[model samples]
Target chain A: MGRLKSRQAGKKFLAVTGLFAMGVMLLLPIFVALPALAGGAPAAGGPPPDVVAAQEAEGVEGEEVKVEIGRDVYYKTEGPAVGAPAPKTADTEEFYPRYNFESRVLLWVANQQHLYYGSFVLAVPIFCMCIEFAGLVSKDKAMAKKYDQLAYDFVKISLTAYSLTAILGGILIFTFLTLYPAFFGYLSSIFRPVMHIYALMFVAESGTLYIYYYGWDKMKDGLLKWLHCSMSVVLNVIGTVLMFLANSWIGFMMSPAGVDEQGRYLGNIWHVIHTALWNPLNVHRILGNMAFGGGVVAAYAAYRFLSAKNDEERAHFDWMGYIAMSLGVAFLIPLPFAGYWLMREVYAYRQQMGITLMGGLLAWLFIIQATMIGILFLTTNYYLWQALGRMTGGERFQRYIKYFVFILVVGLLVFITPHTIVMTPAELKAMGGQQHPVLGNYGVMSAKNGGINAIIMTTIASFIWYQRGNRVPAVKWAKFGNIFLITFFVVAHLNNIWVACYGYFIPANVRIGLSVPQVAGTLSCLFFGSALNLAMLSKSRELGPIRWGQIAPRSQYALIMLATAFTWMMGLMGYIRSSVRLFWHVNEIMRDNSPWAYTHTIGFGANVISFNVLFFWITILFVFWLGALGAKKAPVPATQPVPGAAPQPATGH
Target chain B: MQTALYLIISIVISVAYFQFIDWALMDMQGLDYFYILR
Candidate 1:
């Protein structure tokens, strides 16, 4: 045990725990900060003349500490001796205890609403696509009708969830008004038209979701299906717009513009809308939310599937799980890039803030972020493996599992390692600087090579020959394709190794910048290979029929796990991004000081993240269950007695 | 011609925006000496 504690295992455990602690610490700060920053500041009833004069009198006549810059006194200059009290100007102490209570509630509501909307927008639509595709390709009419009914049922579930989303949004607005009335008033003044636009969009989205859901039965015919699906497209557009409109408020708060230094209102609202990091965040949030939503819905499907009565039910759920996992991972693939873009914007807006997020004092939060991401990838890979058994030719490919596991573990360890350590002076000396030279390289490109290489492999594995589920490749070019793939992976691995090793020697800014092309290269390999494989398999033969309805209950849980991981990771990363500014309320406008400034441990952060995720899923599940309970069960799909008679696996059902 | 025109426009706009931001930040930092970065 002692030896284990002293070895690499101990190091990894410590690193992982450190990652979680960082999340708690970083997230706690915002809960403490918003109230402090936005609260107080210019209370009613102007200061007594004597109070102002007492501030001016003390000792020196010319030493006026109150330096007014336009309408707002940005700061109070240093005055008198150390023992002398701070020269409290008009609303110097900025104390509004009454407002703070409500503001706190408002902030929590906003955060929750953000999460809810994030999950709702993504989960519902993806479920529709999944069940729709499922129904569309079913072999027998009864089976096809069942799929259609299930797809219809899925949209019905989303319709109810959408209502919940609206209710939550309403609560958020009410909380905002009750808590920070004046601040809300000021923000509202700036966002009057934007809010109107958002309201209109909400109406549009609600109409679209309602019409689409209610019209499902009426629109079951051929051309009607296309029209019905288009409503989904419309709903997504409106949802995206709603997110963007809401972002204007946060973007303005963080990167406030449209006003001069004095807080005077500027006429142009667009200046207020596109606050520095706003657009990137909009993109990031939309994608992240969808991925998160996908996770919740997937988890719901998993939970439901696990409790199914018969083999047919299990089979149906197994497919649902696979569909959910695919949708979640698809969105997830672009998340890191979106995050990178957001970080770049953060740096562009304020370099110090970016450093604080990635490499400075608040860097621990990002360590937590790395850990979450690692878990997300790990869960996704696990789900894929579990899903393999559900596919036809799945058994034969089991031998490749060990290789996938190896690459994944190596990648995760590398991804989560700290760039530099806060060690004792003695420890630092032994390691040569604050970073471990040898161990550090593992954290660099070699590890990324392991990670991305593993992911690419998994993506390749995901493209299982649906035709025979267990059928081996038989095309004449199959050998050549395999050779080409091996060569591609080898070159990709070496390319990462070359870059990562070379990165350490470069300047810090440039070194970090190199991640761009490195990521690009990995993605190129991933997408190109997947596309090529699909093309190759297009004309391939199938030896057996797919056994869709005969899946393991535990396999369904894998999809749920995969999706939940994405949601949790999104929230963790979002928190990290927001916290990078540290004590700054709005770049330079307000400073923050609260007890929640310290980083909480990884265990604590993960628990809370899990709590939020569980809360979302459980509520969503209840909604799904309730909807299913009230609605008439669609007709059961009747297929031929011999399942997998002819492989019908084409696209996701 | 269109590409050249767009390029010219973009370059001019970028340069102007960059300079404006630099000037604003410099002015704010120099005058009050608030630790905006921190």
Candidate 2:
């Protein structure tokens, strides 16, 4: 025993020392680069005589003009304005070479892959923080330990993917430099300072993440655990900042600001970073990353559950899947609202761009997106309902499933209905127009909005049912609370449909405002109904200890399907957003004069998205295998109780 | 007044749809029977 104790002590000592060494090594690069970064600035040069002469001639007598002109010369900004004369071919040629092959497709794959890994690494740490906090607060030692173990497992999966993210990022840069050197150079010149900060933050995130993972065992007790969890916060902050910096680059491309009509950086890097679309894009991507991460993690849990040999292993993985799915669905519910805000911002930035996306060329893609979203919600509800099988009292809610299913199906049918159909001239004539007379009305935003809100509310209702699946509410007012909850949902649904219907009669300007109250109605049901359910269940009686490992195998497949759908949807949406710039490398500022400037057919786009999804799944499965091998070598601590044993609720309330 | 009537009627129909489901399938009065505390 003493020998084992000494050996363990030696291992812990080495682990701590190794972490310290890694931290120092990581900081060494930052320290060396700091001095260089501090001294690095564009070479001092006066504004060109012609620019100064022109400014004076035009009587542009302000500090802003002089400053802008000076910065323009330094940054080599030379793009045409929105309505200005088209830039000469020679000017555009200097930045982008005439590539023989399709460079855009190559860049697309690289970017999407990087984003997937980047989002996974960024989001898993957040899950880690939440789970670790849950562990810290729980009075039940066994349950707390289980939470910690689950968190540790989550970080482990992301650790391998982090290395892949960096590798993919390097490939992305190399692709840009080789294929689109001119365009990359111009962008780099504009975002020189941001690039430096991004690099430094990357190093910080890497160091913090490594320390957090390696020191997990050592910090499992008391004060060190809190410190360890705090490291996750620092990691996430750096990660978010890194993401924001990258987003600015994309946002600037989509909606160029802080520059002249002739693509010139106007001295204010802050303005360039905070372009009009920046915040909306940031919000959209953050929510997207969280949802995608949840899907991926849930898929990982499902894989483990399917392969487990023992009931204990199965039970653990089953619980993990539930937590991951719940987190993912929670983010999924509000994702459409974020998407709506983004589209609104897009319209605000440029009406033509918005019209092109929604009503013109890219409208078909939105229809495809509707189909994917419908599938996502349907799968989520199905998984939740399937989960009910593990609860003893869940049978009581079984009959209600059919009703929810009816609502979901109808909503999905409405949500996916396309406004126009692609057909031959004769077919179009037969229909009397591009739209089917009967289905045309269901295809517009009014009907779609109603459909989605109803879907969301139904999903929320499923969740409430799932929460109460194993418990019999013990509160004296449980019936009243249930009645109020049901009534609230009914009313909320009515309000949502009313808003949707009212939108049709209102003018377009007023119709857009209707979405606010519609979303509010859904949120009211989500928050208030959930709150009521929880209050009633606080002192509830258990039907039985939840049979965690008893869930049907089909539900595991649903988890995989959710992940696959999320991956494909993200790829498609990224393509749509990027393509909206249409023929322009930087919106109206810099035109893309490549052979592949035209948008590809929807069929081709779908094929490419599927290829990317397949590639990601294949690669991620390998990563999962690597994680599994590591787990086998150093298994999670067996602090959890045996399978089928009920975890005692934390007491002393 | 016409718009108001349309809106109100739409809401009523929507709410009534769910209410019909409950009346047909769920024994609403038996809800408290499932609650152990009550």
Candidate 3:
């Protein structure tokens, strides 16, 4: 009996030891990772033995070294001068070795995928805010309920994508550390404080997002709904700040300011964070993100619409698709102007860089970008046209589509026209010059501007046509209003064309300024013309109720195409922007000595971008599927309006 | 003189486009009215 008891005691002791070992194995990583998360510093104890031995081996002793434990500080130079080459010391010559393939390509894929998810998560909450507010103020109870349900759906879709964004971000950081460790180390050291702020903001954003999403049903009534919407506003603010902080890092890389030629950090952290290109990049990226988010949401709605089992489901998804598309297109309209501003800033910062981007090595990439833009605008117009089939009197406007199509096609042709062709030596000699006799004229910025502006105006006109579908203005000044709109558009077109023509006769310095007035003319038409139309349709007569689920299935495919085009264009532009800083780690400050520092061929770059686009789409589609699975299990609440049962007149006009 | 001519042409085109839209809307409304009356 004593022997049996001893055996049991031994077994018990063994079990306790195993449990202790397992617990330590699991909890050790949390303990190690916690210090890294807290300002990315080392633990309370001194440096690890291996790190100390490596530092000693590298002769990194007694040099006033700032021992950044978790973060790697690649540069050990003491206050390097601006515009001067960094000292080629053992400490500064940090090696970034790629295993098999090019490290930069891997970095590009990770960065683009991370950006795609980040933009999606950042953009959807703003849409949710606007939609929820609309629901709050809407007098139509049924419509309000529908809007609330839609807003809830948007947040639900974004939630899964948000987790994926964090995962992709972690992947991106790992890629940077593994692939371009030296560059990342230097960048992190300079923006350490901002990184801390960014981490804190991320935590706040996570808390707010969770609270806002979970508190939706609980705060569905009167004052609580308002409070819930206010939470979205808070969430978006944190998100926007986070985006700005991230942009500062990229902007500093593009246009390094506040540091001397040696790539030294100037005393002011704010100065380092707020580089010359910071605000412009911020504005451009924000607008682009909004448009991209809208496209993604619209594509999601389209997918749902296609899979909807009943007419009620179809109607709900249809209306949701329209709303998301409108939001997407609205931001898309102003996106080009923001892009123009960004380009102008790039030119102002460095004319040589701008030339390389627009007129030199990257020019062909711009041609491809133009094709993508043309596809985007064309697809948008096509979707709008297909949407008209849902309206009662929409057939009347169908005849006008051919004219719009003609203009859009011509514009696209001109916009994508290349200044030069890839020809054989003999063919080049035969052609006499790089410029095609006829098509070359259209390839210049002068003609391209005219083409794109025309496309924009035509798109605006299409929107107007869609707005007028199924409705007749009952206002007394309707005729006058129509005449005013016609005249305004004509003048806007004249001004745009005149500016384009005028650019050819002037010096480039003056010609660049002319885009300002050209953009202003388009804005006036969009703002004033839209305002006039709204007033005219304030109490419009409906021809018939719109059949929400009547649009063609092909239109949904167009939305997916739009999102894909957007993703591809973003990747291409990012490649161009980054490649412009050729052979330099931080523009002119630090030279890149890596073997793979040179820009890839256009074909290779295109393939990489396409691959990134494909990967992002595949992953995002999975995220959407996961979201749909959760949605499928949840029964539609009684408070939500039944779609298609009460067909309301289109109020978007 | 040339610029004025171009401007006039643009205005005329714009007006014509507007006129087409107005005509189409009227025609549709007329068809709807007849359908209801009949």
Candidate 4:
């Protein structure tokens, strides 16, 4: 039909636009960087060569003259001052305006809220891209349609949050300008060049996201859907670029570069943007966002499941929750490694900062974070086990659940154990040391690493069992495959524990290296164990139908618990990272002379984090309500029972 | 015998893979993985 041809041409047009947009987003950074590179920033503590030549010629032709130059604090490069040093602010109304309330606390609330919404919006688009791609590649038409609907539902939830993110961003900027004008002004001046680029990228992201969402129905088939899917890739690239640009500002504040000791610019913007902690931060945030985003989506699915009017709705929501949680756990597994890298970079940049975060004042927050991490994994494993109840042959693995719990509980106890406790002089004398003798041994990083890795390995094994719950591998090599998996996991756990035990006997410097191997052991199980399990299940026999909507309500609550833990941990970590800066606005480069520069008590910090978590949840619940308001029927029909594909509504076994 | 052989071979392969990961990752960070031996 002519309509079909027109649709085909429209698909080509959208595809070209998507590719063109991606090219621009990719090239924008290169174009921005090349000019600055070509500008030829000076050597350390000296003027540029051209400037030196000009000055010499002038002196030879006339009277002697001197050209002033500044050395970069981080890069050690030097150039004539391109901008003024950071302003010396007094506690006057001009520098720090206020209305009988604490400015820092207000800004803290604003920034945390903005970051929460921003992370959610950015993470959802990437999820959409993944789900949409999966749908496009799916050979089964019905499965493909369901995937498309799931992706659509995800983007719809984010669309409302996206608008709120922008509004919060504006509010944050206003808060900065009003509360701490001097500090904001100085940062703005330093990051002036890239600020507009960041703004443009935001606008581009908004346009792409809108088109990708609104064009879904029109481009439901063939090449048009591919174009729509590829547009999401462009959208995510822009979103990530925006996040990096924003991270650069924070990176500059933490470990300043391209500026002198006096905080004067030395003409190289790249050094300022790409500070020592930048890449580590970028990696950490990306993984954190993905995990956090998955948690939120899973929670939404759980909410829908609880209130579902019928079995079909319950089944669809249950499957949705599972997929979201799996995606979350996948990212959550690698998150600790990213955190370690960030911590390592912090140590590399400034040892005092690292000490303050882990061993000094903010150390208690880390204890809290470790507790949350334990809770998250425990809840994830519990949910997976409960998920097995929906299958007929699931009872075979049910007896092993207690052992997984035992291992997990042991790991959790070791992980949450503290190295030392605050004690009065008399109490310290009575105890003879800050550390409790036997318990303290378990509190060290070595034991903690072993504990967490064991927990992660156990979670992975649980997932593999869940995946193969009702199916028996029919391949000739199935027996060997099963043995290999079992051996691999058992040995991996032993290796991890051995490494942890070894760390206690080794030098601290060398002991630090042990974590790398321990992490590898855990990751090896995740990749190899899971891959081989999938291979074994490729031509498996089904034992029975996997009853989809038959799961207990408690499993949905577990998803909610996982999401809440993720949100709380995010707030806690953000507080720790920001507070570690101590009294400085930009580390040592700029001082924060405000009355509230001192760190709050741990109790107060916890209260503030709790408040942020509560506020975020209350608002997000509203967003979910709004999403539910427009709902009519379930997105996917009740899946018919099909053998070998438990993922469909009906059958796994 | 085949089952035991399968387990042993898997254990060997897993151990070798882990050892390489440990050495390479630590070496990348400029740390010696066999610091105790050295």
Candidate 5:
């Protein structure tokens, strides 16, 4: 009994010691990291006993940069006389950074560039599908041949863009190494293996891309076509892998797992990469990129249309815009869900950060995001309405547009209001609170749920409008489809509104979960309505001839503007999501520079991002116009997919 | 239908597994990149 007791006591003691050691490792960093990240100095009267001892033993550089009583050390930097920042010495209020802003921003920009470059390269192959479809459907030999050439152009453009992307990647790497040698050292050490994998993936991607683009002609036939399509899939796969690898780094940065709390290097890199938030961020980012890419491509199409000299160009541009819009909106429908999932994970990782994102620091950005989403929906509706005039049965659908306009606009305004204003004490006394009374509810999940669903519902309304005017259905179940369309949306709306209402009263977690069902309902209607409409139109005919080049070109530019808006909004939303950890570099553990970390006003953020979008659009438009300028117009075949003459009216099936 | 259901279940499980592994790898290396020392 005595021996047994001793053995058990020894085991208990070992377990207790292990727990204490682990606790120390975790808790010590929580105390150490905060002041370091905040750039806060030791108290002014005298250095802490510990700090004094450390200062006494300081290295030569440390001794030279002794802390003054009041002023920040960062104020004495040895940079340019005109452009220099304060010195980053012991006296500075600024934290001893692992890195500087330029280095930080470069890495940030590099990561973004990397994601987008891969996205564009991957998207090129996906766009190839339309060309393949055109090749299959075009009855006239001449038309089929034009489509083949178009496919050739698509691949050609991707090849050039791919090269630019590579150059950008190289530039990013060099910038990282040159700007923050110290920070780069710390980063490169941890991510050495990931960087190796990324390098290999890029090489593989380059080779595959070249082969895919060059081999198009060689593999033009049935088996070759299959091969070509397969190559596109491979390209996307590799691109996705690259994105995932990169996401691991970003995700880990936000929620570094597998390490003891002091930010020490852990043995298993995989543990770091697959931090809890990694998967959701990957999902959200990938979807956002696809939607953004679609918008960009669509805008390009619109730009082409606005510049076209004749009807054929207009017709082509119109079709391209419609398809691009469709693709963009299609990906966009599920985007909010992914975003929601990301936010959910953020809350799960740390609730304080999530609260700051929604209720405190970054809430204004969310309001702006709400406004952008509203614009996206509104523009989408207007474009669809314009496109409807070209279709056979399109006129009847025009009447319903007014109702949708009202619902979407009302929902949008309510969605974008700031929940909490920066009120003076006097203002607070008048208002009776920090949070606004009636307006505060609009910033809640209930209002956003309603707003997004309303937006979605409106987009579907536009799609239905467009579908109605474009073609007359030939399906045996045409009557059933009409009924289905009506019922599906009606039921979907009822369900969504029900949840939105109930969400207001429920506990927060339950209210949040309710959104899943609501979103799923909208998706059901969106897909069901779309598929039903497509099936109905497959064998249908045009009620009227499409007079493409007749419309004002400025109207078409609106599509490009919408696309640009989409990109900027996505970037903004991404930043907001990232900045949720209000003052933390990493949530809770690493405090950020609190003053700069607060969100700038919505107006300012929007103007700057719009500038980014505008800059890109102008440059890309120039590229697009340049590409089109060299084009020689080939004669279009008389018959499109339809059986009859110019208008292809095959109405009475 | 049963086979399809089983296959879907298996696929979901596998995907979750892979996603977890991939995410964890990213976390360790990525945190440093973001300057999250703690």
Candidate 6:
């Protein structure tokens, strides 16, 4: 034991030393530039030291030297405008290559494909990090081994997808340069420093990921395992910073900053990167990527489960699917809030852009988005219900599922209803207005907000039931706890609807504030309801062990549906965001005179998104096949079913 | 009697929680939550 303690101390020292080395590597470029920046200027608002020295050496007077200074657009500081204005490109072969196909379409397909693979690769590492950590912390020996294997499986799949991501990224950059050289040149020039850092960070991420994956077996013991897990943290940090740098370019295009009216870059790189929409976009995209990654992983597990040769394989894949779905749903729950914050920031940046997104030409796409969101939640609930069948005591909660169905349907209908419809003259005259007399009432944000929150609340309740499926509360305050939870959800649902109705009666300004309380009500149920349920179940008795592989085949289909829908939604939303810039290449900064500047019809956009989703699934299925092929030689996991002693996977919280 | 008491207490607590959240969030945005009552 003393030897073990001393060895542990030695590992701690090594770990600290390793961490210090990584920190220096991460900040090395910045540190290298510090001396140069310090030696640049001799005094405030004076000529640079190099310029003064050159003048003195040439026998020129100090007063003869005049340095031109420009003010930073966002930071409001004085500095040299080192970058040029955005190029004005004409509709010619020089500016846009005249292929038989549309350049915009080609670029769109490339960008979408790259983004899909990129989000997947980034998201899988995060899952590996979390699951690996869970393994390290778990007290159960067999469960720890299972978790470790699961995390390894996740990384193995990502290793294949990572190469595809890099290939697609290369294709996207080449497409940009070939089709839209002028625009690409300007964007790259303005983000020169940021681009260099992004490239370096990408390289760093690649090195770390390779080491993390390859060193897994050698580092699977003692403090080495802990060090291996920490490496994932470093991997994620580099990945996130890389994503942020990419987001800055798009954010600048949507709402340019740190540049003058003529599009001259200001000296402060931070001002350029930290545009108005940067923070919200970063938050939304991260959550979105995580949820998307979860869906893809779940679908992979489902595919494996459906084709398993034995009960052992089936049980292993079932548990894996559940864990992936839980991680995905965990991110999905807060995704809408992040999206809301993004939309709010868009409105804050430019109200016209927000109007374009929610109320104008792009409004139909939002309806599609709403439908997708509703489908995601519904599928999640359905999977949970099917999952409950594996538990002996789950039947007690089965009766409540139909009521949940009714509530969900009602919420979905209200959420998807359009405020206004495009109608011909005669049709409009027949209806007396653009909105329907009865259904139109449900179209407004107030009602839609209530509808979504209701759906979310029902999902939360479904999750709670799934958690308590095989357990009977044994706490002294079980009855009171049950009563409180029921009362809270009831009131919360009613309050959400009441707030929605109240909005119609009040002034518009005050009505807008109603959404805050409505969202709060849903979140309250999530936190308080779950807390109360867990407390009641703290000393619960299990009715029977969870039969992991006993779920219906239809549940796997639900997982596939969730993943496909997530992919389609990501594609549609990306198109909507890019289209909101309209004819401009960079909002008010740069204009695009391309032939395909106009927005495509909703049908066309939908078709393109569907194609992208289909293509992604086909390729990903191939990747999954490759993973399965390797599984023959892979070490067997400790997840084999042991009669009535199967381990319980963590619930989606 | 015990069930009734529990019901009453639950209603009071839930209502208070929602009301506080509403008022505080609204005030944070510089909006008056009690505009209707006023």
* Real contacts recovered, all predictions: 0.00, 0.02, 0.07, 0.70, 0.00, 0.79
DockQ of each: 0.02, 0.03, 0.04, 0.65, 0.02, 0.83
Kindly list the per-residue Cα lDDT of model 5 for residues A1-653, writing each as its tens digit.
99999976775665466445545644664687577457584311222368556666775446664332221111221211111121122312233333444334445456445445556666665666556555646787655665566566666656656776777678877775665444355456556678888989888788877887777776665544655655666666777878889888767657756444444443445555678788998888777776777787778777777767766666766656665667667677778888888888888877776777777777777777778888888887887777666555667786777888888887787667667776789999988788667656656777678778877877876776565565678777666566555655655666567557766765664555566556656666566667767778777766776554444565576687688788678667756766555545544334444235455566765665565555555545655655565464645464453212222211110
Q: What docking grade does candidate 5 earn?
A: incorrect
Which ranges in model 1 have alpha carbons more than 4 Å from their true place? A1-106, A126-147, A422-468, A590-610, A631-653, B1-38
lDDT of 3 by residue, B1-38 (tens): 75455556657765554444333443543422112223
Best by the lDDT measure: 6
Q: What is the Cα-based TM-score of model 5?
A: 0.73
Q: For model 4, how does the per-residue alpha-carbon lDDT over A133-203 read when each residue is reduced to its tens digit?
A: 98899888777777788899999999999998999999999999999999999998888877878998888
- The model with the greatest DockQ is 6
Query: After aligning candidate 6 to the native by TM-score, how far in Å is the CA of A208 from where it should be?
Result: 0.4
Clash count (model 1, backbone only):
15
RMSD of each: 17.8, 10.0, 14.6, 4.1, 18.0, 3.5
Ten-residue stretch with the least lDDT total in model 2 chain A? A644-653
DockQ-based class of model 4: medium
Model 2: chain A TM-score against the true structure: 0.86
Q: What local lDDT does model 6 show for residue B5?
A: 96
| Better TM-score candidate (1, 6) | 6
**Model 2: docking quality category:** incorrect
Between candidates 3 and 4, the one scoring higher on TM-score is: 4
- Candidate 3: give the clashing pairs: A81-A261, A81-A262, A82-A260, A82-A261, A82-A262, A83-A261, A84-A261
Which parts of model 6 have CA positions greater than 4 angstroms off?
Answer: A1-13, A19-79, A423-440, A635-653
